[model samples]
Every structure is written in C-alpha cells, then in structure tokens.
Target: MSAAPESPAERQAIDRLFNPRSIALVGATERSIWSIAANDNLRRFDFKGSIHYVNPKGGTIFGAPAATSCAAVGAPIDAALLMVPEAKMIDVFADLEAAGVGGAVILSAGFAELGENGAERQRAVAAAAKGAGIRILGPNCLGFANFVAGAPIWTTPLRRPMADARVAIVSQSGAIASQLEQFAYQQRVGVTHMISTGNEADITIADAIDYLARQPEPRAIALFLESVRDPARFAAAVQAATAAGKPVVLLKVGTSEATARAAQAHTGSLVGDDRIFDALCRKLGLSRVHSLEELIVTADLFARLGPVECEGLALTAMSGGMCEIMTDQADAEGIAIPTLADGTLKRLREALPPFATPANPLDITGAAMLQPDLIPTALAALASDASVGALGFVFDAPLKDDARGFARSFIRHIGEGFKAAGKPCVMMSHTFSAVNGEAREMTDSAGVIYSGGGVRHGVSALGHLAAHHAWRRRAAAAADNVPAAAGTTNAARPNGERDVLDYLATAGVPVIPARLARSADEAVAIALALEANVVLKIASPDIAHKTEVGGVALNLRGEAAVRNAFDTMLARVREAAPAARIDGIVVAPMRQGGVELFVGTMNDPQWGPAIAVGLGGIWVEALKDTSLRLLPIGEQDALDMLAELRGTKLLDGFRGAPAADRQALARAIVAIGQAALALGPDLVSLEINPLLVDGARVEALDGLTEWKESE
Candidate 1:
C-alpha cells in the first residue's frame, strides 16, 4: 500500500480544501453561465461560510459588493475558486497568496490537454501555486461541492443536496461527473460529494479517495477513471476505503486490446491493461462496472449493503412474466436465487393461493393485487431462508396515477415487511422510470428502499452486491494467507529452457528431468537410461518457439530413432536461427496422455508482479481464456483461477485420461508465482507452458524466461 500525508498539517489542509469555512470566487460575473451556476449552488445549499466574489472591475455581483481581488477582500480564504483565463493566472495567484489562500480551484481550460505549450503553461501554474504554499485542485476542470458541509463551489447547475446522502462521486472528467450526479439523482440515490480532478495538477483522484474514505457522510464511493498517475498511491487509497467499509464501485473506459503491449512471450502479449486492472479490482474487492448506469446503480446498492453474510438474494414479483425476467437476469448476473428451505416453502405455500407454488423467485401472481398483505407474508417466508442475504421485489412505481395513492397500500406492506425481516431489501420498478418528488416521498414515508433502475440494472446491482462480499472475503483471506517468500538461489538470469526449468526446480516447482546432449550418441544414451520414449528439442536462448523452427521431435524410441531425431533437429534449428546459441538437445522422457496447463507470471510496470493461468498450448492465446491475480498468491487463489478457466472440464480427466490432480496443480502454480517474484523486477516474464498434469504428478514440460536490460 502507498504511504500518505505524514503530518497533521497536511491532513488539515486537505480537510479545509474540501470543507472550508471561507471562500473567494475570483473573476465572478453575472453574464457567464459558469459564474451563474456557481453562485446559484451556494445559495441553494444555504452556504453559511463567508462567500466573497471578486472582480478587478469590482462594482456589484450577485447583488453584493464585489471586491477588486482576493487581496482586497482583507481576509484569509480557506479555498479560492479562480475563474479567470489562463493568461491572467500569474497575477491571480499573487493576489490569492496575498490573502493567504490554502487551496485554489482553477476553472480555466487550455492547459496540459492542448499539447506541449499547454503542458508548459500548466507547469508554470503548478510552480506558482507551490511557491505560494497553496494546493491546486484543477488547472482545467469543474470544481466540487461538499453537500454535507453546505459548501458548493461547483460551476454546474445541480438539484438540491440529496437528503440522507450516502454515495460520493469523484471523476477525472467534469462532464462525466455532472452526468453521474444527474443519473444518481434520477435514481433517487443521495450523494454527499461530487469532485472532479481536472488534469490532476496537485490534487488527484487518489488524493480525493484518501480524503473521502476518512470522511463521515459517504457510505460508498463511485469513481470514473480514465487513467491513474500514481499506482501505488491509488492502491493505498483503495485499501483504506476497503478497510473503512466504504465500498468503491469503479467505471473505467478502456477495454479494447488495442493498447496491449507487444512482447516476446504469450504471457506478456496476452496480458492487456484492462485485464491487469480487473485483477487489481479482484485484489482490492472493488465492484468494477462497465457503463454509467451500472456505476451509479451498483454504488447505490453498495452504500445500502456492504459485505453480506449470506450467499443468496431472494426475489419476488407480482407477475409471472416479471418473475421469469428476474430469474433469467439472475442467471446472467451469476446471482444465486437459491432453493427455498423446506420450512420456508411450506410457510409460503400456506400463505399464498392454492394455485401458487412456492419457489426461489416466488411468483405471488395476481393474488397480490387484492391481498397486499401477501407482500409481507412472502417477505417473512423468504427472509427466514438460510441462503438469503438480501431481498428484492419488482413492481413498477406509478408515474402519475400514484396521485390517487393506488399503490400506497402495496408499498406500505412491502416496506413494513422489509423492516420486520431485518435484512437489506429494495423495491425496484418493472421498467426504468424517474423517481419524482411524490414517488420519493411515498417510499421514504413507507420506509421502502427504492430503485427506479428497473430489472436489468437493479438485478445487476444485486449481482455486484454478491460479488462485493465475495471479493472482500477472498481479498482478506489472501492477505492473511500470503505464502512466505524464499529467495531464489540457482542463477542470476535464467534464460534458456533448461536453465529456466532448473531455476523453477530450486523453488519447489516440479520439472521434467532432462539433460543437455551435445551429440546424437549422448542423446540416445540419455533416452535409453529413461527406459521410456523421449522428446528432443534444440535449446536456444534466442529461439522462443522451438517447434516453429523444426527444432522439436517428440515420441522417439530406440537408438536409431533417437539419434536420427537429435541430428535432424539440430541441423534445422542452426539453419532457421543461425545467430542463436544452441544449447544442444534437451532430452526428457516423453510422458503423454495427460492434461496440459499454462502457468505464467508477468511483472506489470505499474501493478508489480501478477500470475495468469489458463488451458495450455493454443487455448492460452486463441481463446484468450485466463485468470489473473497479483503475486504472493495462496494455494486457494490458484485453485480459484483453475476453476475460472473456460476449459476447466479438461482438467477433470476428459475422455479416457486420468483426472488431473487439482490440488497438486494448484501447488505447482503457487510455486511458479513465487519463482517469478524471486527473479526480481528485471525479469519481464516467466512462463511454464504445457505444465503436464497426469493424476497426482505435476511437472513443467518446458519453460522460458524473458529478462529486461540489466542495470
């Protein structure tokens, strides 16, 4: 984890930057939309702090006398909103510093994002702020609003601060931040803070997370990230948030493999930026969502429910079609709607009509319309089920007909049932809709936790909820059970196939026994000693794919066959890759009829060491089916990776082959990761492909290492 501010002074400055008692709006004007919105928000939030608007022209703004500049305001400002153009920042910072400004939010564009010239200008601005001992929030971005503190320094229009706000939003894009806030409001999810870190000149998303995790109001944090500047800092912030019980729901943009780096091995070529991020999310237990709606909805659910103790979610709906839809969605989301306990099923059967059959996604049918009491009855029955962790019910919230209070009784009964059930519960709409004031009031008064995201997004949130709990548990266990490190002792740089396998063996990884053969006679002698059919391959540090160069001959028997194969392979490799240094032939007993597994370790520049495992050979690349996790992984983590593979059935002894020993395979994988870590950072990757597993025997068939330039 990354280290943070080392002193209380730094902590206090961050606190004052977001929740200041006094602020100055430099360059405030009545005509500009930004000025108008910023002023409007202060009034809307009933900001009690001193709000000083400054203009060099200085006459009147917002019906109050405007100061000529912050210096003229004659008071120390805890935070200053600089709304001037970039050309005038030099003088603006002078005036801000004169007034003892603690933090500055630059609301101008044309810096850092425009090219080299803009980057230079941004640097000058940063230097000026630093010289003045002031922290900067943005040099090109929207400002923030602290609703909990009634401080609105934002430059966009907003609805009233959400009551009982629990979710906080922080984004790299101001425009995206605005969209997220509007969507959160539409979903009736209250927000405590909305921060945008434009260009991240001084204060970045990592800093915001570090600060917000310690704040009291936000129950969950929703992030929209384009990039991270400091990975270690970001990781530390995430760890802090997780420890605080503040679930972080992430929405990142890049997923296309277009950004993947070209490398010499399959592991380096296949591991992309997004997959590494996904591995990071698993390590930190973050709820990573794909779209904007998913981001807000998942965060809302996370705020309502943290780590869950139970494993399943119990759902009910009044219509059979809605029940079917929910069931399908549950399956797609990997959410368990477990079978109802026998006692709970009996109770549900007793309460429902004779036609109703009790099941997981209980279908109350049309009987719920007349008998609203059935809502509570079903809730009580489902809540008692051992597998259920949470409950959800599907019913479209009234758009306008609710004026007659038609659904009031139904909502009231459901809410009362939820309160009595003593478990987290939410009522979702059958379709996506808006939650207007009246609808919000109805749910609030009846004590119903409500969502207007409808079935798709609502069920997706429950899926995220389950994943959040599972990830948290797994992450915790991984942290606690980290394998102790034993430094590698075999060699400094293990490059050739034999050398790589030898290094792995020192780390307790099982490797196929092999000896280097300088001549066909030596190769034949080694094959005879094994008393088994042998495989011969030309070993060269430069040649990664020995088979592609006609350098490999497998399943050779007898003296003539072994000798002929060795000679032919050497001649082919020397011709194909003449500059390569040949390490003769690697002769190992050919053990066939077993499952092949791919275990590789890659040292990501930003995330450090990580391991990936998948079906061996072509599937590792063709299917792109693999599971990745950060290094120092436990045996259980390896088992989990194997279980996640698309071709996992092949490991269960497909066809006539013996069942591959999963426990032994997992142990070998753990050792492989430890071996990679021991090689240190200069080694780019270590791959053990076709780690042939036949029953309880697991051995590395062939291995290679790619190293970076030595210091």
Candidate 2:
C-alpha cells in the first residue's frame, strides 16, 4: 500500500464544530436520562449562540420548536449534536448534509469499537460524512466544550464556565476528557477548550491540537493520548503548537502490555512503538507526563504562568524539616534548586535573624510568622536572584472557622509577595487545604498559584515545568539546523560486511584494518601480512547475522590457522545457510584492551532514522541496555546518549578496565549519524557491533548495512 498524504486537520470544519454560530440538537427530547443532556448543557452553560432543536417527532423540545428533519428546518446548521442511535445515523447525516451542516458530534457507540463488522459500517459513516464535506467529532464520544466561545456541547456535567482561559485539553477518551475537565475545575485550572476525540474516525486528537494551536486564546494544550493515528500529522500539529509559542503537555499511555492491546482495540491501529513516540516527544519539545493528575497540574503551570524562564528553583519555608523534604523531592524530580547567589545571600541574611542561614531551600525560621516583612523581603531577594528560575513558599491553611482568618491573611501575603517579585511563584502545603476555593481565588486574582499535593507532586510539577522550558530552548536552537534525511526505504536490501566497512571508511568512521579474500590462499596471505593475531569472518550479503550462522572465527595466530579457520568457516556457513550466496571472508588483526560497544541506525516507521548505542558483544541483546536518539544529532548529542547508558561507568575504567576513549566514541557516533543522514530514505539500518574502544582509539570491529533495493 502507498503511504497516506500528509494531510492537516480540517480547520474550517473544526471551527464550525467548536465555534459554531448555530447548532442542531439531533435526537433531542425532554424525557430525561441524557436524551437531552447536550441541550441541557448548552443552556446551562449559557451558550451565546443559536441552537436549533431536531427531533423526528416534530414538536417542541427544550422550549424550542423542533423539526422532523434537518432539511425541513429550512436553515443551515453549523454543527449537529447527533444523539441518535447508531443504525439511523446515516439517514440523519444525509438529512444534515442536505441541510448543509458543517460538522457532527456522533454521541453513539457500536461503531469501530465493536468488531470488523462494525468497522465496515464505520467506514461507510466516514465516507458519507466525507462525501458531504462535513467533519465528525466521534462515533463514540462525549463531544466538546468551547468555554471561551461559551459553547458547551459536552454531554457530561460541567462547572460554571470560565472565560478567557489559556489551556486546551485534547483527549482521545471521552470519559478521561470529562474527568480532566472536572479535575481542572477542582484544581481551579482554567481551560479554554475541552475536546474528546472519540474513535477519531473524522477528527483526531492531532486535528484538535492543530486547531487549538492556531487559536490565540489558548497558551497551552494538554493531550491525553492512547496512540497516534497519523504520526506525520501529529508531529506537524506539535510543530505548529511550538511555533505558536504554545506548550503542549502529553499523557501517553500504552507502555504496559495490557494497555497496548487495549489501545489497539480502542483506537484501531494506534498502538505504535512507544519508544519511538518518546523520542519524537523529546525532539518536538512536547512535555510528556505519566499520570492524568500530573498532566492537569503541569498544564495549569503553563496556562497560568507560561513557560518557566529560569533553571533553578528556590524553596523557602519556616520549618527546616519541610524545607528538607521539599529539597529532596526537587532533587528526585531533576529540578535544580541552586544555592543562593552571594549578593542575594547577603541581602537575605540582613533581612532575617542572625541565626538564619541563607541557602537554597532557605529556612526563614519561625520568627517569620510574627515578622511579616521578613518573609516578603526574603522572597524578593530570592526572586531577584539570577540563579533562581522560580520560587515557592511552603505553608498551610486550615479549613477550620477559627483558623480561616489566618489562612486568608497567609494566602494574601504570599500572593502579594509573589506578584511583587515578578516571577512564577507557588504557595505550597503538605495538604490540599492550602488550595481551598478561597485560596485559589486569591492566588488567581494575584496572578500566583497554590500547589497542595504535598512535596511529592508539588516538586514533580515544578520539575515538569522546568523541563518544558529547557526543551523549548533546545528545540528552538535545533530548529535552525535541520539534519539531512537518511535515505530509507521499506524494501529489503542486504549489504555484505565489506560493503559496510567501505561506506563507513569513506565517511571518516574509523574501522579496523581488514581485507576481503575469496580463496584460502589469499586469506592466508592477508593474515600473514597483518603480522599479528587476526579475526576472520564470512562475507555474504544474504547472511547479515554471521555469528548466528557460525560464519565467524576469531584470534587465528598463524597463516596455517588462518587458512584452516577460513576453510572451516566457509564449510560451517554453507551448512548453516545453504541458500545464502557466500561472497568471501574478511580478515583483520585482533586488537586487545578495548571496551565493546554497539552503534547502530534504524529507520523507525514513526520517528524516522534513529541512532542506538549500547554495550556490545553477546551482552548487547542479553542486557538490552541502550540509549536512543533521533538522527541529525551532533557530537554533543552523541555524548549525551553515551552518558545516559546504564553501563556508562564501564567506559570509565570500571573494575580496573582501561578507560575507553569517550571522545573517539562520540566522534564515531556522529560519523555514523551523519552517514545515515546522507544516505536518506534508501537506507534501512547501519550497525557497528563491537565498535571496540581503547584509550584514545576507536575502531569499528564489525559492521552491517541494509538498504532499499532502489539504493
């Protein structure tokens, strides 16, 4: 099958669905039990737009005159909330199309989620909608809410509408979207848009993100993803969002075996390789969170304050124990809470008691409770410190009536201080009481925030916020330097080992000295000329994994041993792979005191060319310890990849082993990546197994390259 065209979301149709001037509520009824839930939500949310009720009975519904058919209504409907049954959907859609409806929210199940039979019917539904040039939100979804437009077509209950919010939640699951919406309300996280892309038969999560990216009202987008249906479209959408200076937080599931299966069944063909998805996220500057709660909280930070500007976090608290706990959590989350600057430290010392030490996670001591100015002064100093990226104060507000006055005062002081500092700030507490409605309202008014999930979640959210900011900077820098594409293809093109070595050598990648010989006498002559212990391996294009086929012999000392091993290798390989057309054998001098490493390239179907490095030899597969990065990477990127390896210490003279040449290893990695990029789409993969690295020396001991037949 040919590849699908790189198509963007139907923006006009999506706009009609979310920003519709007029809507038709199909299957509307006053009987109750969700038959008219969509209508009720629209009215309750005070949708500032026209709503046309549609029912086949042709009577009054929701205090509006109903029409039997959309065509009979004699007016154009921008969006249709189809609460009708699955079987009658085609007919209703036909009438809707005849009436020139632009979009539809199919709040019915029994479509693709059922089985192949249902999937066939779904294809027809998609075809009908496409033929009519209308967009669909779902075949099984709760619909969406355009809070900024005052349009809440969602079927689930919602809190009072919040206008002019900055975050748009785009989700694949209807229930999860609704749950997030409610969670946002509870956390006082204002959301401008909430979209549930159920089934994604017409409009997918990517479509929603793309549409939201172009909208100015939302400063951030939170995505709850099970899988990506169209990777190209998804990537384009993310790029658009990043270009628009919008932060997108993604909650991608399917890491577990059961979830992967469920994801495949839930959204047909959506369970892509999760690792590639992760690499894509890193490349695109999209923040990926594990849990829905983390998604909500992290998005709230972005929506409220935008991206974090600084790299270090400054924590302040009266209790040393609480400060220590917050510090530990911050470290665990990879959030750098740097030491206070000398100037800031001096200022803080002068503003506090003599006994108070000025440092990161500054302990202001209990005296700050009485001396209100002390806390604000310390905050101002920390906020102004160049090292501090963001600042947070740990405090609590009890819900008791007697303590209410103190709580209000504490919230007001913290909010006022943080606002005065002119930096992102948070008032944190060990309990959720610190985020009461009153507190949230106060912080919202003061342009501050209250994080109340204790030190764990509070620090985690801060870490995510910092990472989002850092990734954006990296992505922006890398944007100016687009890496050339690695020639790749879907067809199989096997390359012999000598061909791989020749290609790498031309590209400046270091390779062991080797010569290919077609006869035993030639092999003996080549080994004798090497003047040292040597390795011999069969060279055959059809036999990529030569070791598995018993085609390799190592450490042959003399000409006699070399000739005998060469003959024996040929015989064993022929016995193992009779169909393989053996070309010759490769002979190279054996080198000692080197760390074995694997460097390889892969053409991921979703992410494109990627480089992988790990401990090589037999342990490569057994340990499965490796690091991966997208291609077009530079020397620094290669070094970073190596640093992430679980066995990175092995290269640093682990267990009295000589330290491997890290600089040379990095250069080799870069060379491999550059070669892959130059190869472009025709190249399938290039692997250098056991790229032996001794002190200040690196050599590709064995190599393999695969490409397309066209190449």
Best by the lDDT measure: 1
Cα-based RMSD of candidate 2? 4.5
Q: For model 2, how does the per-residue alpha-carbon lDDT over 126-168 read when each residue is reduced to its tens digit?
A: 9989888889999898898898888877887777776447778
What's the lDDT of the predicted structure labeled candidate 1? 0.85
Write down the lDDT of every candidate, Cα atoms only: 0.85, 0.78
Across residues 1-711, which tens digit of lDDT does each residue of candidate 1 receive?
A: 246543676667678889999989989999999999999999999999999999999999999999998989987789988899899896677887789888988899999999999999999999988788788899788999898889978999988887889999999999999999999888888999999999998888988998899998899999999888788889888888878878899999865342255234468577666787888888778888889988988898788755566669888887787888889988876788898889999999899999998987888888888888888888988998888988888876665545567787678988888887778888888888888877888787888888888888888888788777777677677776779654554458988999999988988999999998989989989999999999998888889888789988989999999988988888888898889999789999988878887888887776777899987765677877788998878998999999888788888988877888999999999999988988877778899887989989999999988887766
My TM-score estimates for the predictions, one after another, are 0.96, 0.88
Model 2 gets an lDDT of: 0.78
Q: Model 1, 290: alpha-carbon shift in Å?
A: 1.4
List the candidate 2 regions with Cα displacement exceeding 4 Å: 1-9, 255-272, 339-357, 397-404, 416-421, 432-434, 445-447, 488-494, 538-582, 649-664, 677-684, 706-711
- Residue pairs in candidate 2 whose N, alpha carbon or C atoms collide under 3 angstroms: 486-680, 486-681, 487-679, 487-680, 487-681, 487-682, 487-683, 488-680, 488-681, 488-682
